[model samples]
Target: MARFGSARFTTVQPGVKINNQPRPAPRTRAGGSLVAFAASAVVLLLLLIFILQNGQRTDVHFFGAQGQLPMGVALLLAAVFGVLLVTIQATMRRIIQLRLLTGRRRTPYTSTITRPDPADADPGADVPEGRKS
Candidate 1:
C-alpha cells in the first residue's frame, strides 16, 4: 500500500492499482451546489434581460385605480401578488389541519374495567367442592 495525501493506493494484482480517496466521495443525488448556482444565475440573467427589453411605460388598471408604470414592473408586481396569495392559502390550510388534529386528540378517557358475559360463565365450576352439580 502506498500513501499519498490522505489517499491509499492498493495493488490488488501485480499491475492493477486501486485508489481509495476520501476527498472525492460518491454523490448520492444529482444537481449539486455548483449546478444549483449556475441554474439560479441563468434565471436571474434571463429576468434582467426581460426587464430591460420591456422598459416601456404602460397604463395599469386595478379596482377603479389607474397608474402609469413599466411593463416589467407591472408583471413583477402581479407575480409577487400571486405568490403571496398562494402562500397565504397554504398557511391557512396548514392552520386548519393543525386545529382539526389538535381537536381530535382531546378524546375522553375510557374505563379499563370490563363486564364478563353471563353466558360464558361455568355454573358447575362455581359450586362448593363437597357439593355435586
Candidate 2:
C-alpha cells in the first residue's frame, strides 16, 4: 500500500566518506587488570577497617601456649580456617567422584527390578491345559 507517496526512482548519489583512520590503540589488558585489582584491594581494606572498628578481641591457644589475639587477626585466621574447610570438603568430593568414576562404587539402581507374582498365580501349580503353564 502507498502511505507517504507514489513509488518513485531517483538518480543514486554516493555519499561523501569521512576520515577512515583506524581507531587509536586500546588500553592494555594489564591496565584493566590493575584497575580490578585496585578495586578489590579497596574493598578488602574497607572490610578490614570496618571489622577492626566494630569487632572485639579474643585469645587463641595452640600447643599449650595461649596468647591474646586482635580481632582482625582472629578474623583473618577464621577466614583461613574456613578456606581450609572448604578445600577439604572439595577434596573429599573430588575423591568421591573419582572413586565413582573408577568403578569403586555401584549406582543405586544398577540391578534389574523384580515385581511380585500375580495374585492368581501359584508357585508350584501343575500345568492346567495343553498350553505350557
Candidate 3:
C-alpha cells in the first residue's frame, strides 16, 4: 500500500544562524465608546416606549397651578425637574469644595523667628566686661 501523505522534517545545522526579529505588538481595542453609545440608545428606546404606553391624560397641580396634561408629559417633566435639582446640588457642592480649597491655599505660612534689637535691651542689664561698650 502507498502512503497518501508524506511527512516533512526540518534539520538544523550547528553553524546556521536563526532569524530572531521581535514581532510587533497587537493594537488595543477601541470599541468602548461604541458600546456606550449602543447602551444609551437602547435605554432611550425603552424610555420612548414607556412614554408612548402612558399617554393617558391626567390633571397635574404644581405650586398652586393646575393643568391637564398627558401622563407621559407630566412624568417626563418631573424627571427633568429631578435631574435639574440633582445637577444644581452637585454644582453647589463642587463650588463649596473649591472655595474651601482655595481658602486653604491663600493663607500665608511663616516659620520666622524675630530677634530683639540691642537698642531695645534693658539699660541696666549686666554685661560681660570684654563685650562692654
**TM-score of every model?**
0.54, 0.43, 0.56
Q: Candidate 2: what lDDT?
A: 0.79
Runs with alpha carbons beyond 4 Å of true place in candidate 3: 1-30, 108-133
Query: What RMSD does model 2 have?
Result: 17.5
lDDT of 3 by residue, 1-133 (tens): 4455757555854543337644444444556777788999999999898889999999999999999998988999999999999999999999999999999989686778889899999875777668868
Off by over 4 Å in 1: 1-25, 28-31, 63-65, 108-133
- Candidate 2 lDDT tens digits, 1-133: 5456668756765555458654454699998999999999998898788678846668888779888887777777878899999999999999999987878565566778888678767754666567554
lDDT of 1 by residue, 1-133 (tens): 4556757655654433348423444564464877888999999899889888999999999999999999988898898899999999999999999999999998877868888898998878778888965
Ranking by lDDT: 3, 1, 2
Quantify all predictions' global Cα lDDT against the true fold.
Answer: 0.84, 0.79, 0.84
**Candidate 3 backbone clash number:** 0
Model 2, which residues run further than 4 Å from truth?
A: 1-35, 54-57, 104-133
For candidate 1, the TM-score is 0.54
Strongest candidate by TM-score: 3
